[model samples]
Target: MKILIDINHPAHVHYFRHFARIMQSYGHETLFVSRNKEMAQRLLALYNIPYMDRGKGRDSRLGKLMYLIYADYQLFKISAAFNPDLYLNFLHPYPSQVAALLGKPSLVFSDTEHASLHHKLTVPFATKVYTPACYKLDLGQKHVRFNSFMELSYLHPNYFTPNPAILDVLGVQPGEKYAIVRFVSWAAAHDFDHTGMSAANKLKAVQTLAGHAKVFITSEGALPTALEKYRISIPVDKMHDAIYYSSLVFGESATMASEAAVLGTPAIFIDNDGRGYTDEEERKYGLVFNFTESNADQLRAIDKAEAILSDKDAPQKYKHLRETLLADCIDTTQFMVNQALQFSTAHPDPVMPVNS
Candidate 1:
């Protein structure tokens, strides 16, 4: 089978990389098409996955709409030539629309329930929509719920093992305490009106956490001059390794928080909107703390971080919680591969060509 996978974010690369390789081992052909969003292409290269670049995305509403047309054209041209039997992506619109036009099955995966705009544009054209069982929004008959987090697609023990050499790279001793803090650009359509940590709170959180542990910040946006010195300088692909060894993770990114939580690190997620997966991580596993962008909640989140840092047993406690989480969840990469192969076998018809 020939599959066309679209990547819109760096995380999407991780989401499908393992599945793509395993599919190839089973004698299937896979093609990746990606936008030049932050680290998406760079990561694809790092993983030795060849992909066609669709071009950089736009942040403004008008620009985004225009880019949508441009990206669709680019992908449509590529898909027409490749004649893929299937399409796959992480809640992206371009592949879904193109798949509909070309008459192919597109399997779109999503975990962010609040991405209402993305859902409207992509779900209708998608042949199947997959989401974590914790996802709050319902996407009608096409929706399929999985008993696992997307992070597990790559971070699960079956696929990943943390490297301790990241400690030397971070200039830390084996048992030294440190924190990973993330800040996002907030330019996505879903992040439209939502906010994360305020400038003041960003400083407060870092400063408070620094007192208990060394702090390294990673931001998609520019950091304030005062916080710039703390920006992390590790290779992009090594981030999960860094997170695995960190004492804590405090961030505006639900993905990073989820990554940390699954890696057995305590995470504090600060955003105006909470994700269902993060909510479950907090409620079911006690591995993450979720806070709103409200001033009170932000402060409370910082306090919680400090409290967690003070507890010397935090690592052992969170690791135990992570084992519980692992036991309850499926290996997402395996699940996705099984689903794709099953769907392809059941639908043996060739994909119809795109109309001129």
Candidate 2:
């Protein structure tokens, strides 16, 4: 079967990279289409996955709304030629719309509940919706729940193993204490009104964490000159390795927090918006801590980080928690590939997500 996969974000590339390869090895052809986001294209190159460039993206709400038609047209033109049996993406509206016009099924993988706008536009046309059980919003019968976070699609033990060599690239030795803190640009539609740490709080958080460990900063927007010196200097694809060996991660990016948790690193998530997967990671597994935009809660995150750093055993404890979390989740990469094939192939395979 021919499958068309849309990669809009860097994380989406990771979400489908492994599944695409496995599909190809089993005699399926996968065509990759991507938006011209900085890191998405870079990481796709790093993964050695070739794709068609759909063009640049917009950060403003008005620009995004205006550009949707052009994006849909571009995708429609491409899908017209590719004639894919199915369309796939990490919860985007474009592919699903194009798939509907072509009378094809679109499988959307999603976990972010705050993205109400995207879901509202895409779900009606989507053939299937795959989301984590922790997701709070119900999308009715078309929704399928898996007891795993979308990050696990690629980061699961079945597909990934951390390489300490990443530390060498960062000019850091193994066992050295360090942390990864992500700052988002708050420019996307869903990001509207949702805020992360303020400039003052960001500076404070950095100063506080610096006293506990070497801090590496990753941000979607520009940093002040004072913080620019701490911007991570390494190949973007090597980020997971950096996260894996880090002592801890605290950030505005819920995806990063969840990634850190599954990698056995203690994580503290802070933002006005909370994600269900990270909530599960915090309450069920004790691998992550969540905080809101309030000053007191944000301060609590700093305190938690200091406490984790002070306790040498914190790493081992989180690692054990990761194991238990893994035991309860499915191998999402395999699950995605099989789900695609089951819909279009010979075996008439009838399967549901393990957790369901």
Candidate 3:
């Protein structure tokens, strides 16, 4: 079977990288088409996954609409030639749109419950939409629930192993304690009204957390001069290893927070609207702490981070919690591959591209 996967974000690359390899090992063909957003294209190159560039996305409303049309046309052309048996993505609209035009099924995976605009634009065109069982909103009949977090697709023990060499690279000793702090650019469609930690809070969080443990900031946007020294410079692919070895993670990114939580590192996620998966991680496994972007809540989040850092047994405790989480969840990459193969087998006939 031939499969075409669209990548819109760096995280989407990780979500499907393992799946693509596993599919190929089974003697199937896989094609990746990606937007040159942030590190998306670079990561594809790093992983040696050949992909077609779908152009860098735009930020303005009118520019976004234009890019949407441009991306659809580009993908349509690529799909026409590739003639893939199925389409897959992380809730990206272009694949669903192009797949519909090409008369193929598109399977979309999403764990973000608050991406209403994205859902409105993409869900109607998707063949089936998959989300974690803990997702808050229901997508009616097309909705398929899974028993795992999206981060597990790559971070699961079966797929990922932490490299202690990262410690030497970071100039930290074997037993040193450090924290990974993340900040998002707030540029996505779903992030329209959402806000994360304020500038003052960002400074405060870094300063306070630094006192407790060595701080490393990873921001999508430019960091303030005062905080520049704390910025982390590591290979993009080794980020998971950094998180795995961190004593705590304090950030405005839900994805990073979930990544840290699943890796047995406690994460404090701050945002006005929280993700369903992060909420579940906080409530069920106690590996993540979710906080609103309010002033009071941000302070509380920092306090929680410091408290966790102060505890000598926090790492062991979170490690135990992570084991329970792993035991409860499925290997997401295998599950995704299984779903695609089963879906393709059920609809054995190849979808012929319609004449434009």
State the displacement of the C-alpha of residue 266, model 2, in Å, after optimal TM-score superposition: 0.8
The TM-score measured for candidate 1 stands at 0.96
RMSD of each: 4.8, 1.8, 4.8
For each candidate, give its TM-score against the true structure.
0.96, 0.96, 0.96
Residue 15 of model 1, lDDT score: 98
Model 2 residue 112 lDDT score: 90
- Number of clashing residue pairs, candidate 2: 0
User: Ten-residue segment with the worst summed lDDT in candidate 2?
Assistant: 347-356
Q: lDDT of all the models against the reference?
A: 0.92, 0.87, 0.91
Candidate 2, position 324, lDDT: 95
| lDDT of each residue in 1-356, candidate 1, tens digit only | 99999999999999999999988887789999999998999999999999999999999989989999999999999987999999999997999999999888999999998888889899999999999999998899999998899999999998899999999999999989999999998999899987778899899999999999999999998999999999999989999999999999998999999999999999999987799999999999999999998999999999999999999999899999999999899889887887788667744434322111
Give the C-alpha lDDT of model 1.
0.92
Report the C-alpha lDDT of model 2 over 83-183, residue by residue, as the tens digit. Answer: 99999998879999999998999999999998999999899999999999999889988999877888888888878888889888887877789988888
**C-alpha lDDT of residue 141 in model 3:** 94
Best candidate (score: lDDT) = 1
Clash numbers, per candidate:
0, 0, 0
Q: Report the Cα lDDT for candidate 2.
A: 0.87
Local lDDT at 116 for model 3: 84
